[model samples]
Target: MKIMIMRHGEAEATALSDGQRPLTEEGINEVTQVAELVAEEYVVSKIIASPLLRAQQTASLMATGLNLPAVDTLTELAPEHKPESVLKALASEEAEVLLLVSHMPLVDQLAGWLLEGSRMSPIAFPTATVAVLHTDHLAAGVAELERVFLAPS
Candidate 1:
């Protein structure tokens, strides 16, 4: 299966709470562009995103652009959650190409855990960045980094 781990787009610096922060106009534009690129480049079967406002917004944009079904929200993708949790949440997913929209640290951590099997975060996920990987098993150190689509700030 192919997985595309993505960081949410740029968001407001402050909100009632971190989870309430919304995407800025610049964030919307960049995410739109990146979503278009993803739509053109790959066949995404599912989109699962963090419940945070900004992440949901990014996922919504990508869903619209990709013509995918409604976006699914996952608390495991939250910034404070661990990659193992997200992996557990996705254990039964049957999508060939899955898109996971999440926060920075979690997305970076998840991708690293998927690729190296240990604590190693090699990819830097600036806002609106997406890294694609493939694996036969969900275990660590077995997935291959197929490509990355980075939407420059």
Candidate 2:
């Protein structure tokens, strides 16, 4: 399976809670560019995103660019949720190509867990960054990092 993980585009900082924040204009443009790149290179069957506004917006834009049916909002993608649970849920979908739009620590943590077990996060997830992973099993330390895409600033 091919899974692509993307950190939601840059969001406004004035919301009452993180979940309420929305992406900035620059964020939309940046994520759109990244999405176009993904569309040119991959066939995406599914796009799952956190219910948070920023993630939702990001996912919607990416889905549109990828010509996907729609974006599915998964609460499991919330910033504080566990990557294991997300993986399990995704496993059931059986999509050949899946895109996940989510937040900080969790996105980076998920990447580290998938690529290097519990050892460490070898890289930072900049806003609108996307990492591609190839995996036969949906368990930790079993996936290989295929490549990364960074949206222009």
Candidate 3:
């Protein structure tokens, strides 16, 4: 299976709540370019995103760019959520290629958990960055980080 983890694009520093933050104009452009490039490289089957507004917007852009149906919301993808929960939920999904648009630390942590079996991220997860992993099953220390896509600055 191929799992792609993407951080939401640049967003307002503050909102009524963290979940309410929206993507900036530049963020939209950046993520759009990144998504288009990824679409060219892989056949994205499903898109899952955090419920947070910024991630939702990012996922919507990715879905449209990839010609996908719609983005599915998973609260477990929130910034503070644990990578274990996300992995557990994804284990039941049937998509051969999946894209998850989410927030920072969690995105980083998830990558780390999949590749190294630790909570420490091996790579930096800048906004609008996407990391690709290939694994037979979604388990700790069992996946390989195949590649990464960084949206133009």
Q: For candidate 1, lDDT tens digit of each residue in 4-74? A: 99999999999999989999999999999999899888989999999999999999999999998799999
| lDDT (10s digit) by residue, model 2, range 6-74 | 999989988998789999999999999999988888989899999999999999999889988789988
User: By how many angstroms RMSD does model 1 differ from the true structure?
Assistant: 0.9
Q: Give residue 15's lDDT in candidate 2 (0 to 100).
A: 96
At residue 117, what lDDT does model 3 achieve?
Answer: 95
TM-score, prediction 3? 0.98
Taking all chains together, each candidate's TM-score versus the true structure is 0.97, 0.95, 0.98
Per-candidate Cα RMSD to the true structure, in Å, reads 0.9, 1.2, 0.7
Which scores higher on TM-score, 2 or 3?
3
Off by over 4 Å in 3: none
Highest lDDT: give the candidate number: 3
- State model 3's lDDT: 0.93
